[model samples]
Target: MRKANSYLDLVLNPFNLFRTKRILNINPTVIPQRKEPESINLYVYDYDAENIHEERLKNVKDCFTYKHSNRVTWINIDGLRRTDVEVICNHYGIHPLVQEDILSIGQRPKVDEIEGVMFCLLNMLYFNEKESAVEVEQISIVLGEQFVLSFQEDASRDVFNPLRDKIQFRQNKIRQSGTDYLFYTLIDLIVDSYFVVMERLSDKIETLEEDIVRNPNKRTLARINQLRKEMIVLKRNIAPVRDMVNGILRSESNLLEERTGKYFKDIYDHIVQANDLAENYRDMMMNLHDLYLSNVNLKMNEVMKVMAIVTCLLAPATVIGGLFGMNFDVIPYAHHRWGFYIACSLMVLIPLVMLYIFRRRGWF
Candidate 1:
């Protein structure tokens, strides 16, 4: 039967040529996780010009008092799973769509203005040297008049510790300013972290450039491809961040004060610089790939040239041996006393003559 033949083909086809014949569902409600397992940690800190209060709570509900306090409150929820994002969303009046975006770890860098909150989504990128790959984590920030809430996918690591130190030491204007300025400081810190990632990438590119020149091999090619992929991931995350900062500048929301506009613009400029660096690195990666290919081809051509010279040198001897190997009774040197010596001499002489000609032509 035709159906039996079809089933047999499906079972016997080693290449799985018909694997794609199955219909694909265009709509699916799967929540994709891009990283390994994570644990949730909540940090709540409230501060003013002369005083500071910090607390690390195991539950999000425990921070309700600080969230509603008169002072500037910074509630950072690191890791997405343990605490209910919906409860935090309800506490802050965050939109349903924004809550979904927060839950979805793979959301791109963006900015959204809801009823009374300013929402931002961005990626924190770092180089994992042990794995030789770039790791990305999403950071979500919700800005309000009295509170600033941040969400991240990983609780084990972050780039905000310096900002925290600055705030605790009362070393900067962060304590003297309002929540909007605090928001600005946080954004500035995140943008500054991009430079660190870019620096690592630059170092990688430089090292790879040297490796390509010194000893290009399969491992070198693999590293080049890996770097290329990491660069792409950086560019993908950073390009939208630039646009998001620009969007914040153009937003008419009162949450961002007019005075903070300049700060956002400064962040914008930094993102642009980072983007340009990523682009330059991409171009360098492409050039390295091309150089690796050309090097391989040149080496192959050298090997082929040597082989061709060897074959040419042996051709004369091969012809002479074949001619004398025949069983003809009347060959040219068949009866000469020194026929064997003369034959050997010609064989040696012919190759020497060929070698001289090849040398003159600079074949080697």
Candidate 2:
């Protein structure tokens, strides 16, 4: 249902998306320039709306300070606004096509290695209470020998917070390891989030299943539809990440170290688990739909039973009324003093006889 809303909003309110300003500010925390290995230079920075006032262009200069290939470099662009993104793209020697890919806000998770640098686009998502939905941003990471660069369409979330902690914490393998490990850690974090969301979805499905069995109605159908839509969106996002992880496992590129391969395998396992849960939920949804239909049929049958009983009871009454309604002067009941009493007696007895017959037949 959110996907449906997003599509409608994109078509009808495309202009408003820009007019609506983001409250979140981007303050890029760029790593201080370090001595370059004559062959490799590495640089990484994070920028968004908040810090835009003090150091927008200056951070690009910092990114350029490390320019050698022997060292890996990383640059993270947090905000997706055209002006903010274009300025850094210009400084980093990013291709027009790559810039175009970055500009596309709905870009799916993918990795493209260009020349010596590996460019990766990923979705960073978290739930927003105000919006009542998952908020997603495009994250672009550029990996070069000696450095890795990451970009975000917004600054509100620190998608790499764990990775940052790992890097800063002493004796942590991330900082002591190569850029590939840093890359794996970042992907691992995103993949880990899928489980968090899947757990929530599983709880919802369990509740819905109970509701369906107890009282399947319009509201239950609505809930099922909503869950179905959410599952679809999750599947769409998670499927590619699984394939991308598998690609990393299969690729001959040195970007994925053999030591780190096991972790990627672990991420792949999570994806498989998530996939299984999604499939189970889909089956449950179908069963619920069927259950709703069955409930409706049962209600209709009850209604028909009541109507049939009323018609059978009313048949004798109609005949008695029609007989008394005659206008002929020779009618025996019309001349009789007990006419009214006889009519009442017949009407009461007729319904009793029909009721007894119905009870014997088990029609009630």
Candidate 3:
């Protein structure tokens, strides 16, 4: 066997201990979707001016009995299942495209007018305190001659309890109005919810502003980036909703009653306000990001100024030592008995005089 001849060859050999080899797991594991079906909840609220009937239906077919009822019906499906949405939408004459939009996730807010129904889909936003983040759920509403069908992606919570109480405790205006008012009322509740979320976000921004002004650090920068992302998402989701509401107001569908036009107009104004607020918040985030950078740089410049002053004040001492320590036969102050003491005095006195000059001139 041949051996390495010198230290260079030995160090460069393949068998040396200095080299390292790594085997990476580039093939990530795939997580499969569950075959079991998630549960779906169906609720029916049928009401008129004199009386109201509310029930939670166990079977999907039971919901159809209200389809032909003369009273105004509100069928709220709390969870999305493709088969369930297709069946109920088919019964209500809702088109297949509308059904797909109802089941699809992350769809943009839009309005659609079909043969017998006027449909709109939008996002419902919620602030999660524990996660310090914004959460979103998709909601689709179908307005027909006798019924208003609402589909929600989440079943845990919604912002419709007030409407429920109003219905249960004899809110005469909604009870006396037609299905179009119920449709309008449902969309109105969604728009009103934006104000609540905006309030919470505003409070957060105010607090973050104080934090940025008082003391800025890495955590402050992280929070700034996070809030900037949230504002972008908030703005993106809200901007489309204004157009969707405007489309509804201009819709030619016969399902929209002429009397409800005023109510939809009010909602359009509110959406515009919400969009404006989102834009304002996005601008504030940009300003805060710039402020954070400026503060960090200002502090860094302070530290560098101090270091430069110290280096300048010590310059005389360094020069004197270098001159006397040179290995020359005729160097200044090299052979005198008192040369060391005299050089030390010069070193100390020169720095003191230079410091006075710097103070007078404000260089430091």
Candidate 4:
């Protein structure tokens, strides 16, 4: 029972590391014929608008009628928080390891070839105003010869919306295309979003660069450091996925069809662009550090100049005060009242003369 509860938590608990709080599950089966042995079973389950466990089971059963070779069925589950995900995974012959991977949120982008299926886990990042940070989520894809399975951290909103729309419209090549094409389309959406996120990061770096150059406040430095850390995290998550996507593009698997390879190529291109942008941002961050140091040095020089002028102006006054402070009765200022006035005038006049000389000489 304890182990079972742990498993339950894995499926039902919302993982926050990636900033996502929702999940969507898609189950597609391919069938070749509707009659006879029904060689393929096609089920496109749109698990939207409903969240009940019984409803989930009923929906899965509805698609269980026939498995035929001529047809491919797709099932899409929109909410990640539902317990039905675990239930459905158990109902299918899906490996517990795959289910484990799905339940574990915040995993980096990666690819795993398990048994005969290719499991691809990807990260999608979005800037969240509420959180004031980039929110990341895991998108898991299972590729097989007959069908493909996909899972999203949140079904409520995501890059996969376009793929959902394509499925709904039934007008595009998606409906007529193979499951591999559908997979490629989904990948294309993710890669495109990566570009969008890269642009946001680049803009941030640019802003920081400007701030550091013009006004390098402590607060600005803090923000730049924070952005640098975020970029490092982003790089760690994205780099491996770039390599994995490249591998998929070059693989001979029919899982990515010949026509669909172009879509993967597009994703690869975006990954390359994103990688370049990330490196550029890192370099800019280093430059900002140097700029901050330079600003500090320039400010110190300005402060020293003001101090030097104040000291120079006070030199003559100090000398006159010392002469009057002497205990010698023979001092001129100590003897006559008019002598004190004369001494004060000399003290004032001497600083003015010195100041003029310094100004003329450009010593200041």
Candidate 5:
């Protein structure tokens, strides 16, 4: 019931999407930086409206230096280490529970306030073009009064570089705003990536729908089923995130500045759009399933039609042969010279007449 009212407030305004979705077209990609195998990477951007400093820190303890910095700081950890996350959370006054959520991978999307920090744990979705599937990377963010700490499951790639560029090259509102706005920007980018993924999946569904129309075989059926399952995963991830956004909106956490409310609301609207699109796609999958079944039925009907016509054409031959082969039969004209020829001719001619009639009727 609460969820329903929250959704009522969350209108999927496309105009707002155009203004808010800053990175939808650019595509989220890795910047191709090399890292040691299985080692944690810590990158920090300490910035304010006037000045900014970016660095790659060698130690987790280096992040503590920005804990109380006057400027808004964003500490992005590409890979997760339990001890490192714990130490940072302890110094930053984040609750143990929130730290656990950050360290754990594949946590359900949620929002909560603990020890004056706004924490969000959700999946950062990306489209894998090569495999033609959605790939999820768990992202957990802890937004404090002056800093935002983000933990990503995979170190290879992420959707944050575009936001980084906005901070670095461009003098955007994100740089001028506080940690809460930074938090909203991060959430907004993740939501925008959802649209990217949905667009790709939509293309696949379109192509598969056409294939189902022209020629749907066992392999095609399998592909449809696989996409349907992917839809389930999407709904599961998206629905909760919508609720999570609502939780953020309703929170009275001081860490989330009141001015940032509008930005977070924009995220809510985009998420609703993604969730609704997911449902539309699910319905499309069902239609595709029904289409595949219908085409298979049509093919079966064609085979049955041909078999019925062939049986009709052979009936005269079977009856003609049966009459002559009867044991006690005194068949009329059985010994006649022309009798055998007439019977054979009738057998051949009757089928031809039936086939001609069928052709005129357009049965095939």
Candidate 6:
């Protein structure tokens, strides 16, 4: 069997190439740069039934002042500089491993409960239209008794603006609820943004399907491979998040109230739905790949068929020409004037007879 040409295989089967080569020794602790550089900004806000106070802390020391507040405090520290995250973690009593995970932006999505604090890690995903690729940022949230600390890798964009609006406008129960509810709202916001990404992918898939049908070329194959890679990344990021939500639902931690389980469950359901959509898109992409290969093969077969028919029709002329051009002193057509006309007639008539036979046999 021929090997299938697929980007999915190249991504999923990394070791396949190393089967005949020696493995390299490399350090696993090194952090790779995955995003553009941005300045660190800290935004702290506390809200209650009657009032909301927002503060922009200049130094890490000032954020510690709100640690013991009675209201629901949300401290969002954007930009994950190593020293800055270490300082914030020290002040907030975050676990060392959790801090490391936060600093290591490539960490997978997970939930960890240590020393009465709930640490949840998730990916914030968006489609970059200019680059035609998916952009991923890591978001780490720590839920305590009275405060929720969120660390974001990128400071440029956030998916929690609508939730922030709801809190500022006093439009919902977010202010009345505890920090657990606020945590749930943040997660819900991230999961909801997955649908936006899905919509964009769906649009691209539709356009690609049309293009594959109308004209399959190198450009179309490149697009199919690109979409396949994006879907693979989306699936890899989302699957662990779903597991993290499930972990949250199964936990009996006091930081996450029993009442909040339903909201997390809702987020879990949405994640499942998103995974289903990704699976469908993956299957469709595989089918598109096969469709592209089939189109190419069919086109090639058509060209070969036409060439074969032309060769069959010319075989008789080639044979006749070779026979009359022999270097004999007395060839049959070399002496008679009528012999050349007869030989030309025979060549034309022979090819015409072969053409008729081929047509009648449905070879054309």
Q: Highest TM-score: which candidate?
A: 5
Alpha-carbon lDDT of model 4: 0.65
User: Over the full model, what C-alpha lDDT does candidate 2 score relative to the true structure?
Assistant: 0.65
Deviation in angstroms for 266 in model 5?
A: 1.3
Candidate 2 local lDDT, 272-362, one digit each (tens): 8877776786787788778878877888898999998898788887888888888877877766999989988888898999899889998
- What TM-score does candidate 6 reach? 0.84
What are the Cα lDDT values of the candidates? 0.83, 0.65, 0.82, 0.65, 0.83, 0.84
TM-score of each: 0.85, 0.72, 0.84, 0.75, 0.86, 0.84
Candidate 2, which ten residues in sequence have the lowest lDDT sum? 46-55
Residue 42 displacement (Å), model 5 = 0.6
Please give, for residues 35-61, the per-residue lDDT of candidate 3 as tens digits.
Answer: 323878899999898888999987677
C-alpha lDDT (0 to 100) for residue 42 of candidate 4:
19
Candidate with the greatest lDDT versus the true structure:
6
After the best TM-score superposition of candidate 2, give how far the Cα of residue 84 lies from its true spot, in angstroms. 5.2
* lDDT (Cα) of model 3: 0.82
Q: Candidate 4 lDDT, tens digit per residue, 244-361? A: 8988877777466687878788788888888887787778778878888898788888799878887888888898888789888687658776987888888889889989998999
CA lDDT for candidate 1: 0.83
lDDT of 1 by residue, 207-261 (tens): 9889888778887876786777777778878899998999999999988779888
Residue 10 miss distance in model 2 (angstroms) = 18
Candidate 3 Cα misplacement greater than 4 A, ranges = 1-37, 330-342
User: On a 0 to 100 scale, what is the lDDT of residue 356 in model 1?
Assistant: 90
Candidate 1: the clashing residue pairs are none
Clashes of each: 0, 35, 0, 31, 0, 0
